[model samples]
Target: MENEDIWPPKCPECGSPKVDYERQSEYTGGGYADYWDEFQCRKCEFTWRSDKKTSYF
Candidate 1:
């Protein structure tokens, strides 16, 4: 399960409006970094950070 507090409404990288939740890996038994809310930028290829500060956004 994922905590809502750890997700971001927008991407902090390129500041694009295009953002969504995604899994880093599709394979099972993956590490923590394998599962995260990925943000896609429409203007650039910059992705959001999955760190602690991401929740603050």
Candidate 2:
């Protein structure tokens, strides 16, 4: 679970602090109705979605 209070979440694959965060949209019901918190590690290029219940957008 990633917390918004925590900046630069560590990469789960590489454990690097050099990470980027973004709120992405997903296709749902034939439209972009769903959103997700995306995290990418700049160091290792590892990517994952936040498991937090709170939505970013």
Candidate 3:
């Protein structure tokens, strides 16, 4: 894997750079897939993190 960004990274959205980060469960049903660092933009609802580095929700 590549070097991942640290917590409180810039928001991929709005680009406001104001971001909120938290640890959340990342399992669907089976065993724990992994923990994720969820990030939310202060401006928009656009949220993402280490878990969805390629997409946004």
TM-score of 3: 0.53
For all candidates in order, the CA lDDT equals 0.52, 0.74, 0.66
**Poorest lDDT segment (10 consecutive residues) of candidate 3:** 48-57
lDDT per residue for candidate 3 within 1-57, as digits (tens), equals 854564577767566777888876545444434566878887887888675322222
Error of 1 at 3 (Å): 16
Ranking by lDDT: 2, 3, 1
Misplaced by over 4 Å in model 3 are 1-6, 26-33, 52-57
Native-vs-model 2 lDDT? 0.74
> Tens digit of lDDT per residue, candidate 1, span 1-57?
966564445556666656665655433433322334466666676766453321111
RMSD of each: 9.0, 5.2, 7.3
Which tens-of-lDDT digit does each residue in 1-57 have in candidate 2?
857676757788988988989987654554335666889899889889976443333
Top TM-score hit: 2
TM-score of 2: 0.57
